[model samples]
Target: MQRYLEGELGEEQFRPLRLQNGLYIQRKAPMLRIAVPYGLLSSQQLRKLASLTRDYDKGYAHVSTRQNFQLNWPELERVPDLLGELAEVDMHCIQTSGNCIRNTTTDQFAGVSPDEVVDPRPYCELIRQWSTLHPEFAFLPRKFKIAVCGSQSDRAAIYSHDIGLALQHDRQGNLGVQVLVGGGLGRTPVIGSEIESWLDIKHLLSYLEAVLRVYNQLGRRDNKYKARIKILVRAMGVDKFREAVHREWSKLKDGDNTLTEKRIEDVRAHFRAMPYEQLDATAEAALLAQHDDPIFKNWLKRNTRGHKVAGYRAVTVALKHRDLAPGDITADQLDHLAELADRFSFSEARTTHHQNMVLADVRERDLHDLWTALQKANLATANAGYLTDMICCPGGDFCSLANAKSIPVSDAIRDRFDDLDYLYDLGPIELNISGCMNACGHHHIGHIGILGVDKKGKEFFQVSLGGRQAESPKIGKILGPSFGASEIPEVIAKILERYVELRQEDELFIDTIHRVGIEPFKERVYG
Candidate 1:
């Protein structure tokens, strides 16, 4: 700290150091990102975050795409005090940014997803402990992201991360992980490639360490833009990267990091099964009410998702209300959410990468009352996975790296397509808007991506199509030419109109594009 004040450290050296502690000097104020490992938050931890936001910031915090909470405004000097407070809640902003092993993210419905192959939270928790303040890989070539998923569906969007771990079982029923490397979505977005189809859990940690060691040693550091592991993997190709990792792993095999059955069991014990209520004859009433009430049916269709526990459902509380920014939640609303989570979700809540919160253990019988409570609190808009449930960055409005305002574009799209029935017809279209090429909004993976660009110092938006963040993830393709800020919504409408006309019956927006290809859509838009 003294060396930094004495001008001994340059901006390049000090900037990354500060970012490692989650402190960023934004255009207007300093922003601090609080790590929420695996997106798990107890009611008490959430209340503490609420208090910190109210005291240090503008009474709100933004949930980021990495499943962390970001406080936008704080005095740089006072950041330590807030971090100290967060430490009291067993939380700290460590390795959230910078070239370090960042917070490990997982499926919001990790343990409880109906299609889960394994309970991934325990594994994620173990990784969180193993990597926290890890001495060796603290300052690597560039920032790294790792996501774990246990479900049949890729809710964690692991393919878009630097290291994606999808838990799987071999033919002999032994548990292992399918390892992927090189995936990212910044200036150069690329979906990760599989390096190991199924690595035994005992050797997984060592293999991961080997990969990181290889990347740390060989990844480009001279050019920050090309420093990411994705760049390295692309340059070397997946086969060569795999061989390097294999060579390194052979040296480290059966070393200290090798997993033991006792360690796995110990961590699993912490995540013991939730107390689930047995479904009685009353379960029939909940299903019947959906048929009778159109609003309830719509809400059920969008907000409530399947849970492994038969009598329960995972409920997504929409934070994309038109009145608020996509990821912003007021301190008061957070307090209320904590209270509601205590009552409904066993004192727990989880945040999604798409800026939504989930109550993962809500019983079906309590849906009506919970929905009513949510309605009063403005958390029950029922727009999960819809066109209006957009992923937006705090563009030129707050971020210094942004080219133009992104929230306004998100707001405009919401307003233009406000009809609920119309949104349902579109069917799970991901409309992500990034402020700049940084891809903070994950625009590269959206079905319909909008990037904020500057043309002669004027705000212009570039559009992309057919990108996805699933098992077979693909980067979006540009639609040629940029549009004025005011012209974006109309442009989106035209594309949607073309999609509606070209799509086969009940085909999804992305599926239709895959079948028809980008050229046809490009012709319709530019024709």
Candidate 2:
């Protein structure tokens, strides 16, 4: 795969082809990311991923925030062979790297989420085909990501994605999408500005083409760091960029770029809803009895969410435990998850943007048994939406791009806020940590954002306030001076302490911050 993407080797190659793709080799090994198109994988395909990790790489698979899989491995030369095997299963790493389009991500729960007015799988598939090895986009300055979220809840973390598409229904009940462009994390993480209010589903592809066309034509080429679509959007202003897109789209809207009925149907055929079984009442009662136990109950409450389908649930396995690298899992863990999926839960698992894993369709009756098995493996963490369940990136410790090491800070914060009750009481507070300005950790969208910076060879973290990640998105405002790693936990604790003191009952952290401004919390945290 590396050789193919690099144009270094072809199908009939030599020994020089036996090289790693520079995919971050660690003491743990090289992490190879597999692009899963549209977040949709059949049970058999998912099982193959589990088997691949179990056999060649580590024993677990890390589901990326981008709806792809990353296997931590050591053998670089084996990548091509591994990729070759993946190809047999109808998968490829074609656009997974380089300046081309990265993975096309969509809401993890797009089709199943009842709150969605329409399924976005078709649109995602269309974009996936159009962008795969797209000649014009292959040499863009930096990586690109596109996400579609049809659900009312922003499961895709649309605000932080490079190109965010929210499927919306017009007053006439016509399906369209609200397009947001240029928002990104990584250095200079910024929330994307909206370019189109409502675009008909038919013009979706053409509209996207128009936006990319404008970006491709005008985006900065001198600096790799400043070349993202966000920079272009920011420079031109959303109105001006929209106008440019409108002018370009006018030429292409009714042309071949438009989504055709046949094309839509062909893509839709691949994304047909999975066959589900009727809810089992006995199983539900039994699981409820088992969950009556305190620990099991806690796991159920924290890690499990209600599924639209009866007798099933969306189970999150939190990877936010202290001392464990956030988003890192072993190949053995992947095998176990696959086995669990095959036996007790649905024959499937999901990866969330929050750096967590999900057993998407666990039978209610098997919840306790599943939890028990997971607990044995240290995989069952009851902190999914809590303060401890932080979204973090592989900061300076791994990435050459990082300004500071974020893992240590995350560990320190988790250690200080280990109390489950306190976390539950706080309710859905997001503490996003990014190692650098790239904002891969989505510092801009966190309720309490932490961005790492390098100042005179020392690490400092900048705190931002009032960022929210739901339907109405808002970027965070920077607080005062950056704090050292050691001071982060205390600063975060003090800030939360103020929120507790000032907030009304059931008011979320973001709401309170918005209402009170950062003064009270700033004084408390900095004092």
Candidate 3:
């Protein structure tokens, strides 16, 4: 780093080195992405991140759709120091960029979700250890991403990853994984195909190794645009791809890379259950009945989710407050959030792929108190899984790759739909906005997807409908031609109005789209 900063290293030589450290030269300045391994962070680590942001860059950070925190506006020369500070808390940026294995993501409610089949953190950690600095995969066709989901709901958006792992139990009661491959989103969005119905947990590492080896060998190298594993898998066809993987697996299965019971147990030990209190399961209901403040009640209902443990709930600290850009948190908020985590959630927090923070083990009795604290900090937006709680990218404002700005579009939508009662009436809707086709905001999977486009060097926005992120994930269909940025909010309003006119009782936006089609939406928006 010193050699590069001192001009001893050329741009070509320093490019990969800096990218491997998660440093990207953006439009405004250098951005540093700090990995929050599987979205987990200790309160101390949060505090450390806060301090780093204050000292190195602007006094704010953005939580990316991948569940990593990005510090924009950091000086190129000071990035090494920023990373050094991150190391104080056992965090690093290694492999966060470059054509290598990036951070493996999973359900934010991994251990606490009532619907979870197993805790996936152990396996995520295992993959992290194996992939970090692996010589063979250091330079793949392009960046590789993996997602694991232990729940039936598929909250991690597993279908949109290069490799998706779903945990399941066989008829004989043995734990195993169902593997999906070739899933990705960008210029070409392809839903992952099931490559393996079931594989014993013992062969997890060996099987993954075989898959990576196959991709490393056969994935495209000439055209960067068509280099992702998704393209290779698509070109080869699913059956042929599966056969190739099996042939490769036959050579490596049950070898030294095979996982052992003891090894799994060792990794599992690191994620032992949180120390929880034994309180009545009905305590939350009792408390809610007594609370007359409708605002607090609404926040409680919207932001908190069911937990596996009795008297405990997973609380989402919304970063999508209209006052700030989506997914952004101030340094002061980070410090206060650290304190909140310590007070309510055992000094640990998890970042969600939705760009929010999760306090996974809040006591039911302390619900009102936590809400009060969060509200005061402007962190309690009471809009989880709503239209205003949109997923957006830092577009032309920060990213050089962007063709148009994204934050303003998100702001306009949020401002246009500021009524809480109206949003609640509309029900759960995912509005994801991406600056360009890279789909960093995961626009491809949103129920209402917005992509920024360039029309003869001028900014424009394109809208899509019916996309969803869940067990039966589907890519949204583009509604029509692009519209001016100023025209977006009205366009969306018309689309929603058409849905209200056409929807069945209690039907979701995506369901309405599926019931009819994008034609209805296109007619409404264009008309």
Best by TM-score: 3
For residues 400-424, what per-residue lDDT tens digits would candidate 2 score against the true structure? 7788999899888888888888898
Q: If the candidates were sorted by their TM-score against the true structure, best first, what order would they fall in? A: 3, 1, 2
Candidate 2 global TM-score: 0.90
Count of clashing residue pairs in every prediction: 0, 15, 0
Distance (Å) between predicted and true CA of 2, model 1?
9.0
Tens digits of lDDT, candidate 1, 167-270: 99999999999999999998988889999999999887898899999999999999999999999999999999999998999999899988899999998999
* CA deviation > 4 Å runs, candidate 1: 1-14, 281-292
Report the error of model 3 at residue 274, Å.
0.9
Residue-level lDDT for 259 in candidate 1: 89
Stretches of candidate 3 above 4 Å error?
none
Per-residue error (Å), model 3, residue 454: 0.9
Q: Write the per-residue lDDT of candidate 3 for residues 252-315, one digit (tens) a residue.
A: 9979888989999999998999988888878666975687799998998899999998888899
Weakest ten-residue segment in model 3 by summed lDDT:
283-292
Better of 1 and 2 by TM-score: 1
